[model samples]
Target: MIGFSCYLSEPADEQQTAYLKQMQQAGFTGVFTSLQLPEDDPKTLRQRLNHLITSCHQLGLAVVADISLASLKRLGIAPRDCSGIEALQLDGVRIDDGIDMTTVAALSHTMGVALNASTLSAETIDQLANAKANLRHIEAWHNFYPRPETGLDPCWFQQKNHWLHTLGFKTMAFIPGDAQQRGPLFAGLPTLEPHRGLLPLAAYLDLKRLATDHVYIGDPQLSPRSIAAFQAYTSDQVLLIQTQTADDRLYHLTWHNRPDVAQQVVRLAEARLEHIFAAPEPHHTDERPRGSITLDNTRYGRYAGELQITRCDLPADPKVNVIGHVAPVALPLLDHVGPHQALRFKQ
Candidate 1:
């Protein structure tokens, strides 16, 4: 299930409601929100949460609140208590911090529990297993780092996700949003820390190949263009490409490369498509990186029509036109495309 984050600091205005509706239209099924109760006026906080929760429910979207022990303590709430869950119309809670297996197990009975995906260790999993935690109501999710260069490593992310699966928990991770970013650099927080520079749609599609059950945009909001790209990707309407200087030749030529699922690289026969946009053949073919598409010069000459997507970084060749690379974070999705999958470009 794809989800998005909405900070409590943001207001619940009609614009926000419209954003949520747009997300729903774009194939998002869930949202993550944070809650903090005030000592002076609990009513105000309640009203805020109530409004947001009601709005999400109206759009058929589920809401999960981010909570920590400190927040619970501030609210004077019990670790396993869920007294106002129904009233608030919350679907679940993401226990961001202060994890105790026994308490987590107890909390599972009353409400759905989402553990920190990035922090769950083998020892913790064993403890939870020994405590007989309700795995059904429990899930794992990685937190987004608000600061730059603080996101988790992709290698470790895959390892952790695989580990969580063995323990019967589906894992969720986040990718930064490129549009309407909400942070220091105007790039949303992403679980794969390195993905802060990637296009939001490309990042989302890339993470899908890593077996992440849920992928969310870590920003408070996304732009309309980003929203539309996500919607198109979900519907298998396009392959979002982030082109570089080397890829200018292919980037300007907009012929769809139909995915050949069996081969992992979609083949675009330049000979078949009349509109090559008069792209010049590569004077020099460079090293082809995975997600890099190479224009085949020998197969069809200067009008080199054949394009191949590299599964991994390949040696640079003078014969083929190595135009651009598929953004690194989005590379994992190359293999999952159905045969004849459509493609799209974003420069």
Candidate 2:
């Protein structure tokens, strides 16, 4: 499942509500908010939280709030008694370190509960099981690191996710958004350090490969370009590649990787079909770097007009014309294009 953050630190206004709707239309089905801000006025926090939850409910988005004992007290709801919580129409509550297992287990029966993925231990899992927690409503959620170097190591994260799967627990992680990053430390919230600067989709794909069941945008918003890319991906199963420059003949058409695949580059299957495009005379035989969009020149015989996206750096070849390059921020996506995957270029 894909989700995005909608913090309550600011007022829940029409703008924020509209963003929720935009995100829902873009294929996001969940909203994560935090009610643990101690600095905010309690009354104001309650009002904002209520408004946010109402908007989510109306939009048919699942809403989960990160809660602490103080925040719960501010809302005048006792943790053990879930009646108040149910009335608020929350889909779930993320329990922090201080919350006891009995409470966590009890909350699971009433609503969804997310436990800290990083600190969860075998003993704690045993305790939750012994307490008869509703396993179906419980998931492990990794915290997003606001500090640059504190994010979880990718290898450790993958291993931990594997362990969680063995124990029948769904897992979630965060990736930073491209716009309106959260304040105090704007360095991006990510579960893996390397993901801190990646585009939202690239980081999300990485997390999926790492065995995460759900991915959330840690920051407040995504740039328009990122949103469009995600929309294309979710709605059409097409990988959108932003290029510095592209030949309109190739860029305008959706190309698919050859069924047989290639080790060093993405081979466009239709590029070599007869009458697809005019055989190009070699003009720009620039060195083929990774992410370069290249077309086979007339000197390559029947292979002329064949198009390929380089997967690794290659020396300049007279038979190939380097046409364009994938945007640097999007280079990470080159490694993920699978056999027969559809690719569309955006200049």
Candidate 3:
């Protein structure tokens, strides 16, 4: 599942509705919002939220609200806040800075609850389990840090995600949006610190390797190019590659070769690039063209009938066979591929 951040406190109008529809077309299924902005009037906030939620539901988008004990008090709602939750038709509520374990356990039973992944621990899980919390209604959502240089590390995230998954909890993470920089600092809304400059689509794809259940655009806005990329990606119509430099051949090969979907990604087979398949011969024309995909031409040679994509520019050897070179865009991806990762050709 994927979602985007919504910062508006007022009800929906034509513009907001159109923007949300656009998001849905771009593969977003839901939205996450916070209601604790200092500027909002508590008296009328519920009406605004009612309109927002009702409108979102009409468009088939689920809404998740971020709330705290203080915020609820300000809204004059009870700790359980069933009326507030019901009125907004909220799909879930992230317990911002989460309350006590007792409240956490209580909320999990009646409605959906999202807890901070950073604060979730073995002790917290045990306490919740002891209280008989409904695990199905609980989700571990990573926090989107507003501060610069405070994003969580990849290794730490992987470790935490692995721990949560072991306990049967779904996990969600936020990725910074590349387009439409937010006001004030104009930085991305990111759960991880190092992802500020990464394209939103690429950020989501990279997190696929980590197996996050949901990826959200942390920023309140998105760019048309990013939205188009998501639209093409979800439909599997095209695989949009994000690269800092231009690589025409790589782009052409990927564009024409098509892409195959795996558990968490789509891959193009380098083996499919072989123009002519031939058995290796005893002739030692083992020219190892670095960074080239090649097939052996020699008969009865050790590497006969094999297509190998070179990772570097090794000296050309008599025995090495050269077929094609990866485009600049594809070069960076090669280093990150795992041996067991599935690679398939679409067309």
lDDT of each: 0.72, 0.89, 0.69
Ranking by lDDT: 2, 1, 3
Report the C-alpha lDDT of model 1 over 1-347, residue by residue, as the tens digit.
89897766655688888888889998899998777533335556666678888888989989998877666665556665556343456788887666467877766776788888877778887787788878899999998887877888888888888888988898888887765667456656888976787767767766877889898888887776678777877776676655554555565554455543435356764424764534445555877767886666653555456666777667877667766667665565565456666666566
lDDT of 2 by residue, 1-347 (tens): 89999998998788998899988888889999998888898899888978998888888899998987777887788866667766667898888745689888887898999999998899999999999999999999999999989999999999999999999999999999999999889999998999998988889889998999999999999998888888888888888998877477766689899888799999988878645768899889999999999988899998888888999999999999998898899999887898889989888
Top TM-score: which candidate number? 2
Deviation from native of the Cα of residue 25 in model 2, angstroms:
0.7
Predicted structure 2, TM vs. truth: 0.97
lDDT string for model 3 (1-347, tens) is 89998765545578777878899977789898887766788767777777777778888888998988777877777776556655557888898753577777777776789998888888888899998888899999999876789888988898889999998999999998766656668878788776776767667776777878999888877887678767877766454544322223343443322243232222234434553344645343445433355555554364465555555656656665554555443443444444333322111
Off by over 4 Å in 2: none
RMSD of 1: 5.0
> Worst lDDT window (10 residues) for model 1?
36-45
Rate residue 253 of model 3 by lDDT.
Answer: 43
Ranking of models by TM-score: 2, 1, 3
CA lDDT for candidate 1: 0.72
